[model samples]
Target: MRYPSKSALLFIAAGALSTGASAHMGTDLHSHGSFMTGLLHPLGGLDHLLAMLAVGVWSAVSARRAGPALLWGPLAFANMLVLGALLGLRGMGGAVVEPMVAASVLALGLLVLTRQGMNAAASMVLVGGFAVFHGLAHGAELAATGDAVAPVAGMFVTTIALHLSGVALGWSLRAANVWATRATGAAVATSGLALLMQLA
Candidate 1:
């Protein structure tokens, strides 16, 4: 089965993005300091949701060259996220981090859009780099929310779930036709662009 055309994909993306693409969590999850808070924080923002899913989408599409892309990409993101949390605990990041996090959506969406012949090493770096910003955000929140490892673990688990969803979405599209990946990529990238505009 064939998916929608490129134009259709872009149109869909534009519509989605135009409908308020910025990602921000208004709820004060940090004040609670619980594992549930970690699980829910990622879902609070459009940017986090899209970026994490794009990572999984790219990895799933990229696994044809090497299986490492599937595991390594997510691993890099998750570990770096923990590291970012440490930095947050120390109050290392500030306003500068927000734009970086917003930009990550654009970058990952681009990767998904161009999901052909990507270097596994480069992909890891890209995914890991973007993850740092996201991690910092997570860390910044968790640090304020609570001083417990459970929250971190909960956050990690939620991230894994999001990645898996992206992987599933990518593979399902791949099963239909390879071109669908590009469509998916375009959609994700367009969403990122919308988020960037919101930030601006």
Candidate 2:
């Protein structure tokens, strides 16, 4: 696959730097604690959307170059997301969740930008680690309501669907233009950096 040109990289960096400050960290879904609320929560934040998509893209790209087993990265993310959410339900790890969620976006975007591949085990661990923070951020919001099963389940299903969609996109991009995938990664990475700045 071809690498992104220096100019392209510079442009992406400039755009990221120019992004307006905004935070979608503490979304309130407590008013209607239903499956739809949980399902839509991931779509509510740019950070969550990009990070989850990046995971799927990374998994697809990695599977093509590495092995089919690497496709399990998304599953690892889903499982860990639930686990982290459970912890969040108990009001644990509230302090650093949002920052970590932002950081996950940055890390996952870089992974896609480079199209890096690791062993399946290592890949799952990395993805799972990032997913925990995402789950924690959302789960913390629901702590007070104490009704987590339906919402968490909805979030879980939506996360998988998003990952699959990303996988399809990544696969198609890889087949048509490798550069497109790289550009997508660059944009995602830029968004991640912008989100981090918002947190900062």
Candidate 3:
């Protein structure tokens, strides 16, 4: 009997991971009660984690041909994440935040999968648009607590670190195997789709 191809195995892994895409925790900031909680928030959820990493991967992959300028995608995401969180603290951008967050995961995954490219402005708008929802989710939850500065700061720093990690992974994958990068994208996209389904 023949073993599954790498792509098949990758997709299987993606399916396994997506099976539990609850998207976000429903707990309040007071429950966790620390900046570290906010810092760890993104990593706590599959939806946020994949989308954040996808931004870095897409940025680095695009930058391979577009020059270092394409790295701005991740920066755009990080900046907008803070903006979104602040807006969320104000109780804005709440109604559709979850759907939008899941959509970001799907969209960013496709970008990496297809190796899509766009001008700097368009890229920033796209990534930043999605980041707002991620931030909004965080902000909305934390809004009830009345202490957002420290948590948001933690999230901001963590977001940058996650993006940098993704960029490194993207570059390494690009050098070793383009198929692997696309496969990773495919996995991310699958997770996003699963997230959307769960939200629905």
Candidate 4:
């Protein structure tokens, strides 16, 4: 039987630690500590990192207008994500935020495997929605610690970097195997399912 690699298990362990750290920080948003905490928040979580990377990979895999889609899709998602985080911080919603996030991973993976490129406006809408969810997830943690601006900016930069990493990873793999793209999609979808299970 195939098992998750050692690195994968380590990733899971790290994510749990980060989540605990965020929760325990307890609504503090101005300490210099929050900056580093916020910066690592996205990278620490497997769900967040994979989903963000998948956005880029999927964008690149599309047969149509791959360039802008790869760049813009994640950007739109990130912008809206920040907005969602603001809402969460304000206590505007229930704490059951993980479901929505898991759904995004599953949806984005399927979308990449299935959808052809749409017109520019529709494309923006698609990417923007995902970005909002991603941002909100990250943003929700912000209410717990450090200087909001620094941590947020750090996360934003990290988010962009991760997307770019995904794009690069996808592009590199694309050259070697025709199936590489779909494999990434599958990996993403599987990861989402795992996250959902953990959340449950």
Which candidate leads in TM-score? 3
Instruction: Please write out the lDDT profile of model 1 over residues 1-200, one tens digit for every residue.
Output: 57754433543464376337446655464567777877887877777877888788778776784354577787788778777766776777898787887788777767777775456677678788888888887777677665657777777888989887777766665565666776677666776777677667
Q: What is the lDDT of residue 35 in candidate 3?
A: 84
TM-score list, all predictions = 0.85, 0.85, 0.86, 0.75
Report the C-alpha displacement of residue 82, candidate 3, in angstroms: 0.6
Tell me the deviation in Å of residue 8 in model 1.
12
Candidate 1: residue 176 Cα off by (Å) = 1.8
Report model 2's TM-score to 2 decimal places: 0.85
What do the candidate models score in CA lDDT, each in turn?
0.72, 0.76, 0.78, 0.61
Query: Candidate 3: lDDT over CA atoms?
Result: 0.78
Candidate number with greatest lDDT: 3
Per-residue lDDT, model 1, residue 138, is 74
lDDT of 4 by residue, 1-200 (tens): 34433433343344344333322233343344455666676765566776777777666655354455567776776777667666655654454566767767777666555534565567668767766666666665666663467677677778788778767665654454545445556556666665667677
lDDT string, candidate 3, 41-132, tens digits: 67767778778878887887777464667568889999999999989989798468888988888888888888887888999999999999
Q: List the residue pairs that clash in candidate 2.
A: none
Among all windows of ten consecutive residues in candidate 2, which has the lowest summed lDDT? 14-23
Write one digit per residue (lDDT tens) for candidate 2, span 1-200: 55654434543453354355344533654566778778887777777877887888888765646455645899999999999888888888856888888888778878877888887889999999999998888787766665789889989999999888778766765664567667777787777787778777
lDDT measured at residue 147 in model 3 versus the true structure, 0 to 100: 76
User: Model 4: how large is the Cα RMSD against the reference?
Assistant: 5.6
Q: Which sequence of candidate numbers ranks them by lDDT, best first?
A: 3, 2, 1, 4
- Candidate 4, residue 180: the lDDT equals 46
